[model samples]
Target: MNDTSRNVSFTDPWIYCLDHGYVTPMICQSTEVLCFLLGTPALVWCLWISLSGSISGGLKPTQIFPMNLCIVELLFCIEGLFQTIYYLFLPNNNMFLQVVYCLFFIAWVCRPLFQTCICVERYMAVVQPVAFIKYRLRRYRMGTSTLIWGLAIIYPCFTVSSLGYLTKTNDVLVSVYCLGGVVISFCCFFILRALKQPGPGEVEGGRGGEKKQRTTDPQKMRAFSIVLTNLVIILVSSILVAVGFFTMPNSGIDFYCNTFLMLLACNMLSVVVSPVLHLHREGRLHCRKGPVTN
Candidate 1:
């Protein structure tokens, strides 16, 4: 009877949550395995590609942002992957629980700071080209990056092992809003870059002195595609974070959705390195006329 009761409590939704504060139902175990197994390899490959490019070309302003993102994602993945393992195998020791919270909190908070850095950098480059050039001239890009890193390192200090850090409804609401805002900004920036008018020199007559519509450079198009892809992936993860952070309904669908989101959030930043890998594979950034002009 004791073994049977123990087994029941192990898989039971109500007692299970009470016993293991961060864990979910046994039904969610498969989702955890799937996300960990599939996501980790892709992220590892993504990191390798990003790291290789950084070593070969040195870090450009754009590359710096993504590279930092890649590193943050890797840390998150390592911590998450371990948490899943611990939940399955080890008994919930208080010390281990504190450690898990510490790592997860660090990844949770720092990941966004790096992601915001990427968006702001890309927005400047793709939308406000003139300002981007000025920022580069004044070394503002480096300064901004330095500031971001400092904050990433510091933000986790206050939150390590604190349940309220990520769980507070107010914080979750703010993060969801900020994340959604950045996603929209990135989309707008890409559209503006793609639809930008031709340079003054490129304006030419076709048959009867009409200005011809110019196509965007293939290289630039590819770069834009890659960044957009990254933004979309990260935005999806952010939504997941919001759902998991906030109190949602206890229905079956809601449970599954939040679990899946939690799993995906572990390594979604892998998308950050995909663009860099694609650039390396294509031998240059996809757009023909590069946007990172002086």
Candidate 2:
């Protein structure tokens, strides 16, 4: 018995209190693989389109937000890739674990911020076009982008001070998600109002026994739809996070692993879905049938 016990201990030295020690890493690896598969092609295509458009001077100031979003998704994919590879190869390496966590943490926080920034840019364009003109300067957008990236980088520094608890980081995420929901909702209200109002050339002359008609701008309605979509996405993502946080305590190992896995799934989903929506907005995605048969 002593000989058998010694052999078992030698082969598997890592001690774990959980019933299933490998469950969490298995979940992480699976989800990370899915994220990489789904996110890479879409994100790469988006980056290419955005960069090509910029080179040709066809990119708008508003479009930069989606470009920023593409960058976030790329970071997210890279984090997942690193995590998957590290766990598969060096699961016992604490140093690599910390590096993966830091990358994951930064990408996790930045996703919502960039999503909100995109909605804000669209809000200004749809709600206050006149004011947006001045704010649309290249420097303004660049400055705001720089500020957001800076904050994301600096926010993780608090983890060291917090002894790795991440309490404050969680608080920041909740606050940002809530604020993003509010901003997107506000944009929805204004967009709906604009959609109902008639534009300058929408009213036709009624003097020649013609009926007066009111027409809405296709552009405004499109913006309204986009804002509504963003609101739904933000609300759903926020709810997922809230549920995870609220139910975290007194949970079983499986529950904890599942919760974190769900959160990662949610993050990857939003990353993939947001870019597809933006691609549609940018006129990159389309459906067309082949030529009609004789």
Candidate 3:
């Protein structure tokens, strides 16, 4: 009877949530496996092709954030892969697994920050071209990237083995995620507005400059697509975080499962979308006449 009751409780959503404070391992691991299968190959392909061009020539300002995002997705994929494998064998919680799970939080934290960086970069490029050109040094992006990476890695590392610290960290992250979504949305709006307005050169020189800007319309449209896509991704993620934070406490294990599954869904979306966007921009899937210039 005890064993039977234990088994019932193990599979029971509310009971399991109360006991474990996490989603059921079997369900979470199965979802992780699914995400791994779907995301890895595409991410690897995108990263390789992107690196090929950027490495042989030099890294363009536009390429930097996407590459960093690619790396973060790869790390997230690999971590999920590792967890799936680990759970396949053990199927039980342990201190080691908890530590490994911290990687998930680290990736989660990094994703929004990196995405915000990408949005801001795109915004400056399209909306404030003069300023973008002024501070377009690789070092500036490199410094920002370095700082983000350090903080993402360090914050989770120090919060190790402490659920309180982890919870606090997540609370802070949720706020940041909300802010990121707002920033991305505004960036998208401004980029769209920029698309309609004439550039300074166009205003000064009239129709000829207008014609030139029209010729670059395709490039502007592509930039807007990038920002819009990012806004959607960030918005979805923010909703998930808000849902998880609000519901995970009083909810059942199924809610936890769905919440995490949606988060991974966003990850998969990013993996697929980033590569598609990169390919489009490289003209690998399309033809282009001249490089994008404002």
lDDT of 3 by residue, 93-144 (tens): 5665665656777777777778888888878987899999999999899899
The TM-score, computed over Cα atoms with residue i paired to residue i, of candidate 2 is 0.78
User: What TM value does model 1 have?
Assistant: 0.66
Q: Residue-wise lDDT of candidate 2 within 1-294, one digit each (tens)?
A: 332122111112212212345465466567678768877887898899778878898767777777887888899988989977775688787677667767866787777777777767777876798988879987787888899888887766556345634555556666776676677677767766776677778877698957588676666666567667777877787677655554443344445554545674675677678767666666666663322222
Each candidate structure's TM-score, on Cα atoms with residue i matched to residue i, is 0.66, 0.78, 0.75
Name the 10 consecutive residues with the lowest summed lDDT in model 2. 3-12
TM-score ranking, high to low = 2, 3, 1
Q: How does each model score on lDDT?
A: 0.56, 0.68, 0.66
